[model samples]
Target: MAISKPAVPPRIPCQQCPLRPRPSFRDFTEDELDFVASFKVAETPAEPGMAIMVEGERNPSLYTVLSGWGFRYKILEDGRRQILNYVLPGDMIGLQGNVMKEMQHSVEALTRMTLCTFERERFPQLFRSQPTLAFDITWIAAREESMLDEHLLSVGRRSAYERAAYLLAFLDARAQAAVASHTELRQLPLTQQHVADTLGLSLVHTNKTLRKLMDQGLVRWLDRGCEIIDAAGLYRAAEWRPPKEGARPFI
Candidate 1:
């Protein structure tokens, strides 16, 4: 399916960005903030189930998640789909598309989302004029790569129970970092089908495994989402430790 474009773009000032000034996010210099403000061209809102970007498309813009959730996935020739990663608020999207010729995977919004759009062609200018911002961009890319590597390990070696625990814990940590909130429960806007596709399990198996986690008090299933209940327990169950992260830049 073709991706949908925003009907109307919203104008958001960089100085007033919600992600800025949070303990988990880095503060930009006056000049750097002004540059990013100019760099941003538009803000687009996507509804649930809409494709923000499609596989193999040469899109002209890069995006940063301003709010809400999305997932990246690739479809095989046989029409089997594998989810690669989840995109949360404060995460950058389409960096690969900007650096390469086309997008390697598709990103679909799991909830109502707002994305900040930047011109791809001007990224080089940011690198040339603002070395710090450039470094932050590279840092974001490396962080994404590290997450993918961990996910690979989880899928390849971990048992279904361990994998489910690790995935939930990972998502909870990311949500906490993005929002800088220590709330006991965070909404995960995903279905059992998404969980199944991500973990390479059948829907029935996914449901059964999730029930086990629910019984253990690690997570609670909701009508349209899941709530992370015991993050520490999940970490222990998965034998995983979250990496320490410094302030992250949004753009």
Candidate 2:
């Protein structure tokens, strides 16, 4: 008799999953929640590296990152690629589609992903009908712009050590915001390839820099995630400073 392989598990719906427990629903009023529910659909499952939207394509949907990391990238005619950004849970990925209709870059899943997709027609309607959501999206876009500006600094001026240090500090801050503790660091889902693409550094150099961080007693990369051992030391190496103005708030 031939041996049979085990069946692959079916993907879990976002509602059923424990990871994304509707963090934003309470932020909406009952009427607002109803309106959003009418426009939003159940989660769309995506495989790792699946391209959700391609450059120059006529995009008709805007997505919320229900649970996963995604890469936004643009390609040059000569085939060189630059990763524009990474979007995490609760982040909006395709808001540009709402206005531009034609996407300037492609969005790909960095892991097995679930996205809450909304029709372009209904998405903009929410902005007009729901002023709160409009401001929320506006703030989100502005935050993305600020992050892009920081990336420009990292690529243009920061050395490899500074680049790696900056990323560590930034990741630590993100985890603190969500979990409310600077001592606790979130698991970094990024691989060396992802870091290299995002930071405009070669993969070999990125790996070397990460190892140097470990040697310097700034961070320890365990099996699950990186532990930030010395937060102040890391920030000092990166020349990081808090914004003079407050960071743009996003829901």
Candidate 3:
């Protein structure tokens, strides 16, 4: 319902996709590149807080985030929402809806976002002709599942301090990978409410835990987001380390 039909932004051809050139991503072959260019139908923008996809809806289009951030979530009848995971540029969305009959969860933009839309009907053709790109799509889904696995660990077993530390450290590492420049560090673009929702903690508890980290010089809470001041310290506090990922595939 939140999808808007404003004038399209100047589309970036798949051959010149900025995210493709990032070291974190693997380069596509010429054939794969050409297929992607055709697969993409248009470029669209979603404003902050817009609902990109809703539960139980069948979406005809898929999207790859061109810029900015979003989060996947599910809501209950009583209005309780659970934040599933945050999405970054180059991440594919609407796949769950495309593959299944309807969306099981919802997606909402956390910041102004640019997204490359793909025709859903052509998705099967890629799998039939381009096995490698099909594998890339599978890999992307697996990676998302892996993130959910870790979140499960945090919420099910980790303590409040450990949860806060692990969440920030994990997000910082993910942001670094998604960004084009490794040297240009940025904030997590998250508020305490987002943190609490994601971690399954109360807002007051989330604030208290964040304050504790700030006191230890592990992280800083800005007005709109969070900054990891000492990633190593946070890792130590959380007793966790990020995985050493090689160049990952994206679609």
Please say which candidate is ahead in TM-score: 1 or 2: 1
Enumerate residue pairs that collide in model 1: none
Model 3 TM: 0.94
Runs in model 3 deviating more than 4 A are 1-6, 180-184
**Tens-digit lDDT string for candidate 3 (184-205):** 4558999999999999999999
Q: Per-residue lDDT tens digits of candidate 1, residues 1-251?
A: 78888667557798899888677888789999999999999899999999999999999998999889999999999989999999998899999987679899999999999999898899989999999999999999999999999999989999998898888888887888887555555778889999988998888999999999999998899988898788778879878787877767767
Model 2 misplacement above 4 A:
1-26, 175-185, 221-232, 242-251
lDDT of 2 at 31: 64
lDDT, candidate 2, 1-251, per-residue tens: 78876454454443343433333232445665566667775458778889998999987777877666678999899977778877766678788876786998999997777777777776658777889867777878887888789988888898988888887687666545433433354456667777777778888998899999989888877753467788888888777776443433233
Compute the lDDT for candidate 2.
0.71
Using alpha carbons, what is the TM-score of model 2? 0.78
TM-score of 1: 0.93
Lowest summed lDDT over 10 consecutive residues: which window, candidate 2? 17-26
Output the worst ten-in-a-row residue range by lDDT, candidate 3: 177-186
Q: Give the CA lDDT, 0 to 100, for residue 225 in model 2.
A: 48
- Give the CA lDDT, 0 to 100, for residue 13 in model 2: 41
Candidate 3 accuracy as lDDT: 0.88
Model 3: lDDT of residue 82: 88
